[model samples]
Target chain A: MSEPRFALGQRVRIAARDVAVHHRVPAYAQGHVGTVERICGLYGQPETYIHGDGQPFTRLYRISLAQTDLWPDYSGSSRDRLDIEIFEHWLEASS
Target chain B: MSDHHDHDHARTFQPDHTEPTSDAALLGLALRELLISDGHYTAQEELRMMDAMQKASPHNGALLAARAWTDPDFKHRLLNDGANAIKEMGFNLLPIEFTVHENTDSTHNVIVCTLCSCYPRGLLGMSPAWYKSKNYRARVVREPRTVLKEFGVQLGNDVEVRVHDSTAELRYMVLPQRPRGTEGWSAEQLAAVVTRDALIGTQRDLDINAVAD
Candidate 1:
């Protein structure tokens, strides 16, 4: 079994990239910094799963980000937060 | 289960768009027929699976939540290992990751599938049409408070709202806080108040009076 890349509460940033195919990372979450809320178990890469390529399991993490930080004009209470599940390959540790 | 099945009727795609049934429905029927004829799966087995899926509803989740609310030890197990905890309740949740997010006075949670309409269909049956809408998938993460407001869930400023985007394999269901004034209610009674919307985290207030309705 492969170890998880990031631990809970660890701050990490989503890698901003433009992909032309199926991916789990949403457009709103790209390049946003958030803390790992939960270390969701490993799963096959979704981009490959759609094409029937299910191998090499990747770690998944649920990262939590403040709504204010995610959107420039987020018209909501500042305490609101958004949690998105991101794969290990799409994240980088932020020091 | 107030016969609110009309929600799916307002979906963007109509069943009679091209023929008597939608293209996707026609394709699904053809695929099922081919699979049965090819000996991949029997029609009886397929019908049994469909019946099992239809039997799954929010009642399963409500029973789990009600049990947890009344039992501290069960609640601990539920929060720590949701899959096993649910299994202990005599339900099999295989090939899917099920996580329970607890709601408290300080924090609230909502669930959404940003990538697609991935949901805990084994436990909650079919997902609401709004949950699979393009608008909901796009806006819930960006403006959860606003989307929740549209759902009539207004959180107090002191309580921080958290939106869980089910983008990957893991599925989430909110363990809504036990409603007040039901202090001595039976587990069956408590489960009666728990609606599908409450389990999905769209609605916070679970009305005991609504149980009669």
Candidate 2:
């Protein structure tokens, strides 16, 4: 197993994906840019690829977001903010 | 304006919105009555829970908020370890027992469970109805900003949202930030500023003139 390749304050973008059941990643965030604020310890490997009690994937990074970036026509106070958690594979370093 | 008046007349003539025919209301009433008969709780306790749900005021929360506003050290303690810290301020979080987690800029926290309304009943009293509904459990984690926006919270793109998996023993209560413009205010006045919404993180801490509103 390899250590997750993300850290706090790093810039990243969400990758596009589809699944039938619930997922921690939101659909709207696909391809959107965000900054990692904190690293939430870890979880096992992505269950999608792993099976039979295999080593779990490491989950990390709590990301802060702006309201306007997530939704269009959002005119709320600029100081207002949101935070969310994401896994390692869901993100790729922004160029 | 005639259309408005005619619409109002028709609405006034129709049955009241308070009609008690809804199955949920009937079921809730039945549950209350059964619980009372079974000695699970007195009518007064049940009423207290109802009143808290309606007005959502826990006098103890107000007191703690007031103290925290004035005392930096106490506020730090509460932020670090909420349960025991609140006890030092003279409030108890053990009616049914719960865990309180503070959400911050680095980490956001929302509480929910798909199974049942397992909440921190100790501090906030009983959980609100929406907390248990499938709508909240399903959407909060996936679309936190949208859900919070519906609740009148508008977070910026820079903030993060973290949804917690609340189970039997562990639950959550949101401790909002202390507002500005409350300089030199007494604990009583500060308590007046802290509303029930602040406890659940639905509303931000009260501004100086917020009490008037």
Candidate 3:
């Protein structure tokens, strides 16, 4: 298992890999920038878990993305947000 | 044991979504038979597991929610480490990660499984069918305010709506803010007010009417 690369409160971007496979990140969340709200303990990667091999469990994080940043014409409160659990490989350090 | 059989509403989930049912059912039956035939699990074992899962109801989660309302320390532990907290309550948790979101004055929390119907079954029982519907899975993340309105829950712009999308790794159960009045009700009495809909966040306030006289 790989050690967690991201820390809580760190800004990270979800990779925009849109190719069709068993991916966990929803299409709407691709390429979105969000802050890591938590460092969930290591777990099996879903992309591989579907194909019968989920070895090398890696880090997962609960990311908080602003609701306004996600939708083009979001009309809700500015404080609205989306919390999603993301696996490590799909994330990269963001500014 | 609320089946939440409120499908009478026309627009919640498309009641006519019968396009792919047979295909999924065929696949499910095939998988079950294969598992039994291969001895990975017997038919009786499969039935027993189904019964166990079905036996789990929203009552378990209601107990915890009511407990949190009554016990400050337990509430803290539940919010901080949901997995251990539920286990401490004598409930068997699955290997999957468990987390709880608390509703507050400034923010209202709701849960959805955009990818699939991933729910905290051990704590809250089988998710209502609408939760697994294509309509809810797609709309809850997009227009939560409108969805809440459909459920008769109207929140002002002041309360930020926070939607938690279950990406399947971590399961979530929402802790609703306890309603005012019934100041000295027992924990069991308080549990009666926290509906599964409120626990899921589509509904916010507890239905005090549910408390037995």
Candidate 4:
């Protein structure tokens, strides 16, 4: 297992690149910024697993985003949040 | 802007979306046949597994939640190490990581799989059809409050709603706060009000006095 590059409570942005194959990153979360809510342990990347690749564990982080930040027209209260699991490789440090 | 006649005509020719074939069912059948033929597993073993899964329902989760609600020490252990805590209750969740999110007066927790429908099947049985729908998968992360409202869970402005997307290895189940007016109820009686939807965080306001049939 590789050491996680990002720490809990660190701000990170999801990579905006498009992948043609199997991937776990949701299209809605792409290019969005969130704080690492938890270190959800290391696991084999699903993108590689679908291609028959062996276990190449990577840190999975539960990133938390305010609902209003994700959607411009969000109708809920600003206190609402959405947590998405993102692999370490797909996250970039946010400025 | 749309005419009533046009809407009625469109509804007449609507496709039978409910009758769509399940590719997962077909694939499961094929895999089971192959595995049995190859002697990897026998039909009898598969039947036993199916029976076990059938017996696994929301009641199991309700029992656990009822225990947590009555016993503070058990609740602490359940929140700390869910997998081990469930094991103590005779459930063997070996490989799957189980996590319990407690709902309080100020905060509410809901579980969803934005990537795919990953759920705590060992405790709550199979995921509901709505949980796997594309609209839910896409909208819940973006508009959880709206989706939850459709399921009759309306939170106050002061309450924070947190949606947990189970996109990876962890499976989550919400431990809803015990409803009022049920102070002297036993664990079994309390479990009656712990509906499957409540365990999933969609229905929080449970009527504790109603008896299960």
Candidate 5:
């Protein structure tokens, strides 16, 4: 509902706290920090998807997280990274 | 290294090979009957919808990939706005969002649906069973290089393996790099070499032999 709280190339962290809301952020990505890769257009909240006409559209973003940051003992190329789309509500500003 | 659920998937589902006689099936039938009787849709409309869904195939993605390889402008558009670009190619994508990930020499892209197997079904047809398997959904985001190896795609550290975890609203398809030895091949020939796995990122190197004379 609020204008996209984050901007392109901005650094942000996914909300580590578990909330009682239907969200798209993955569990593994929670609390991890990443760069905003792309500023995708907004869409309805997942909870309101079934009958979402007239519901406010929330800004969605594609965040790129380094593989090294995701796992403590990742056994793959350090160059590897994971990108996942998350709603603005589940993200917080991070240094 | 771990699973979200403690139980085995095999303990619950074997519905694929069996006929539907479960409560879920009855509920589905009831819903269908209600919709039809309530004039929401006729049985013919339902059949037509199913027919349209079945019409999806990897051939659609192949055509897109080949066209992108040949036409720079089309490729730019495809990478910028996937849904519109695909519609320009004569494919009416569903209302959901679509994004095309380009696999370059330095960066390899793989797609997975961590929550559920969300894919660009409109462009590339139904997802492969393995794409929907829990193992792939779990491992692809964690140790993608190892998973790629299992799928016969060996990537080096020089290339960044970018794993995309598709969400409910957004879906992804990878536009693999054009294979070598096709100096002046036609779009048709290039499409012939594009496989479903290639479009999904599991199969990167296109077999040049597929288009050989």
Candidate 6:
């Protein structure tokens, strides 16, 4: 299997296609910065939003992000963080 | 567990609009009982919780307002772990540990459960009539921008819309960002900024001007 899309502390951006309907991924941090907190098990390939066509995919990642980086004026403590599940396809290495 | 039935109100979800139904009310009551007996909530707290549900707008806003005013740490935590972090204020999760996703310009978050009304009832008292609507569940993913506009939440040309399909394992809620202009306010004052509609991401938090009116 190809290496996971992101590693711990690696910056990433959510893919444009995964921004469509019927997904579990949240919208706020689509192109946001989050560190790889944990590696969830492989759940087969990316889901085919196209009905009836299941394509083979790679592993997914559970990322953790600080709230400050998410909201521009966030004044909370440093410990505040949000965790989300992103498929390999949804993320791309940040510049 | 086998067949979920509600005598008070019918558990119907209509996206466009809803006519209050006794079945849904009954189902709400039954669900409340389930939470109470399961030790998730107490009788007295349930009454307040139900009242908060009925008084939806301002009552729901209380949590967000509080976060905006004093607990900067909490505001961040809530944005991070939407449901769990709210408990610090004594508001229990309606039942299950629901998923809460914050929506911002870079990204927009919308929620739907294709099969049924699987919401984070713990954080948000009861699913609103529109949330249960098939229109919302079916259309949000297909055409997010238009749907959000209908709800009065217009997205910027630069922002991307992300639809979330809620499931049995995970429920969804939204923590909107704090509005500016309320300087040096107490937590109580800040809590007032958050309305029930805001938590669901249907509306943004009320600003100082909106609060004045």
Give a tens-digit lDDT track for model 3, residues A1-95.
46689988999999999666687889999999999998988887777787777766878899999989999898888888999989889999999
lDDT (tens digit, per residue) of candidate 5 on B103-122: 99898999999898888776
What TM-score fits each model?
0.88, 0.50, 0.89, 0.86, 0.89, 0.51
Give native contacts recovered, as a fraction, per prediction. Answer: 0.86, 0.04, 0.84, 0.82, 0.82, 0.00
Where does candidate 4 clash, by residue pair?
Answer: none
lDDT of each: 0.84, 0.60, 0.85, 0.83, 0.84, 0.59
lDDT of 1 at B210: 83
- Winner by TM-score between candidate 3 and candidate 1: 3
Quick one: best lDDT, which candidate? 3
Report each candidate's C-alpha RMSD, comma-separated, in the order given.
6.3, 12.0, 7.4, 9.5, 7.7, 11.3
Query: Which ten contiguous residues of candidate 2 chain B have the minimum total lDDT?
Result: B4-13
Question: How accurately is candidate 4 docked according to DockQ?
Answer: 0.67
Chain A TM-score relative to the true structure, per candidate: 0.91, 0.76, 0.92, 0.92, 0.84, 0.72
Model 2 lDDT per residue over B56-151, tens place: 345556677678768879877766556678778655554322344455665445556544566555555566788778898766645666777787
| Error in Å for residue B145 of model 5 | 0.6
Q: How well is each residue in B127-170 modelled by candidate 6, as lDDT tens digits?
A: 78888898986655445566778878876656555455553345
- What is the interface root-mean-square deviation of candidate 2? 7.5
Q: Who wins the DockQ comparison?
A: 3
Q: Compute DockQ for each candidate against the true complex.
A: 0.75, 0.06, 0.84, 0.67, 0.73, 0.06
Superposition TM-score, candidate 6 onto the true structure: 0.51
Cα lDDT of candidate 3 equals 0.85
Query: Which of 3 and 4 is ahead in DockQ?
Result: 3
Q: Per-residue alpha-carbon lDDT of model 5 for A1-95, expressed as tens digits?
A: 66778999999998886666566777899999999998887788775665665266888899999999999899877778899999887788999
The best-first sequence of candidates by DockQ reads 3, 1, 5, 4, 6, 2
